[model samples]
Target chain A: MEIADDSKNSKRVVFVTVGTTLFDALVRAVDTQEVRQELYAKGYTHLLIQIGRGSYIPARSTSDNGSVAVEYFTFSSSIAESLRSASLVISHAGSGSIFETLRLRKPLIVVVNEDLMDNHQEELAEELAERKHLFCAHPRTLHQTIASMNLDSLLPYPAGDAKPVSKLINKFLGFPED
Target chain B: MMRENQWLTSMAESNGIAVIVVTVLTLILVRLLYVLNRCGKSLRPTTVKPLSTLIVLGSGGHTAEMINLLLELQKDRFMPRYYVAAATDNMSLQKARTFESSSSSEKGTPAQYMQIYRSREVGQSYLTSVGTTLIAIAHALWLMIKIRPEVILCNGPGTCIPLCAIAFMFKVLGIRWSSIFYVESIARVKRLSLSGLLLYKLGIADQLYVQWPQLQRKYPRSIYVGCLM
Candidate 1:
């Protein structure tokens, strides 16, 4: 299993998005030297971070090997374009962020913020992880989650279909099919 | 003698009025039973020309989920869509308009955006909310009367409460029979959201859809249709 370093796998981007709210812990956890080095080791050439409203600003840096170029930003109008280009995504457990990554069929790691309201996000992240849709982690367990990641093991979450629900409504409304 | 005749006629008129009121009330009650009974059992496949739809969009994620749900909806079937949002929620209204413009280019009815009083802000005092809630209900009543939409599709959102209630009231009054369909947001796992609970507990929603299996298990009335959006 020499899957660690495959040749010609340059320019792989690991996008870390904390969504709209402040997730300082998530921003901090991913910006650490250890995590960045590990990502670089796994052939991730760039570490992109969307810090959201967090105060802990990560300094831009590149390792001696000139790989894993780290960059951080506040917000983007739409994260979809960025998400589409991401090779691996580590994101906050917001339903919007989670679904966006899942819909794009990217390898996702959902880090739950324990401080936020309640364990609502935790429930979703855990449930989806159990279903093998993505990896779920606490801020503390993030590095370990990243180290032992298996992107291939993740299942493609089925594209959500509202057609059935709509048809159900049409039928419920007693609309005869034309 | 003329005064006596006038009094007798007046008495008969009042008596006639009371009888008519009683008869109308009884008929309405019976029709209520028939409509609800059919609703409770199964979908009574009847005919209606181009059903009018009211879509209640909430703030943030609720709005997002609803828009996602609307994308797959049969455009031709749900016509003349009236989108209702909270008064303070300017973004949802704009978003709905954008959705409408995009869909309007296709072969569907034009969508109209309307606003109701927010009822309660996130951190607003409950006392103040009462007054606002009443106002919101009034707004919903007016909109319901004006639109008289044949169907309502709403996910978890506070704005939907008054609208669904007014629609249900229409059903009870035998004024209009608008089917209310509530979809619990995918965010909800073990329990229902406040909006979902109200619709489910009060039996106002003609059909309540839950995305998760555990939720359906906990609330036996909810039909589990897997993930919606």
Candidate 2:
């Protein structure tokens, strides 16, 4: 399935992508029926989903106009194109996903893996949040955060003056460059 | 009747032998338990720093593990001045350079890496082992004199033996050299042969850091500090 190039339904359509394991958890966490009904009431037409490795999020079809479609996993090229076409991107906080969303300048909501030890992803999300690059929510707050988000305003701008390597080096050296 | 008497005498002798064996075994078990109890007290993770700079001697995996530990240690109160001594032209030195750069940047620790040349071949023969050991000894002595580090931590197999020997000699010269032997992992014990055995027995190191629980019983001065890494 492809996002239309016309940008006519840009505001009406939301693109959600998740890695397989996290997608399942996210699907279980949200009230799929309520979400469908809410989108239907709002007159939204389409929900585009890109499934991760072995994930399959079942479609909830209450209206003929509004439908959720799952796209099969393909190569990075197609995925990058899909991300570029997306109006709002919801994704797991994997480095690749975060990087792609930033590179594409998409409105992104990043959900971190709480199951993992060290909470390294939380650190990454916090760092990005400080830069105003992405919106972050834990699984607990995901539904409300996603619903309340102002997508148009939150669209990522160019990464103005953040140079990650230099920042990392400076942090390590305990001295910032003059 | 004569055969019955002989059988009774034989049974009595066997019973006496069994009693002697049981007594000896009981004494050994008691001694072993006492030793274990003593070691258990000492092996508790107490914060102790080498008196001087911790010179990690070796190259490759052992050095890598040591560097990782050093990085972890830099996060806490005990900040020991450290240097890595490696063979000139060792590939591990290149890896060490990358680690040192990245680690120094991340942790803000001022750790330096250096290479030392061996005056003789380390793996030719017993005589060469001796000669190489002497050259390594001389190199270490010069380094200790220049750096004046109180402790020389040995991570190398052949090179460390000599360095520790030199440290012992320096101890004789009234220089207090606290030597530490870091056994990488339990798996390494199976790989050690005659020389490793000798190094294990000579016990030059003031404290031996072992990763395995089983080794705690073998080395009297060993501190089972979990995994160094």
Best by DockQ: 1
Two-chain DockQ for model 1: 0.41
Residue A143 of model 1, lDDT score: 78
Query: Relative to the true structure, how large is the alpha-carbon lDDT of every model?
Result: 0.83, 0.52
Q: For residues B3-41, could you state the per-residue lDDT of candidate 1 as single tens digits?
A: 999999999999999999999999988977776675544
Clashing pairs in 2: A172-B105
- Write down the worst ten-residue block by lDDT for model 1 chain B: B35-44
User: Candidate 2, residues A1-178: lDDT per residue as tens digits?
Assistant: 1223444553455566664234555543433655544444444455566655534455554335454433334224366777776666667766556766666767677877676543445655665665566788876777666666554444354432213222222232233233
Candidate 2 local lDDT, residue A36? 47
What tens digits encode model 2's per-residue C-alpha lDDT throughout B56-111? 54543455555545454332232345564557536555565666677665465545
Question: Residue A167's C-alpha lDDT in candidate 1?
Answer: 73
DockQ category of candidate 1:
acceptable
**Model 2 Cα shift for residue A124 (angstroms):** 37
A46-156, model 1: which lDDT tens digit per residue?
888999888999889864584588888899986787887788899998788888888788889999988853456688888899999999998888878888988778888
**For every model in order, what is the number of clashing pairs?**
0, 1
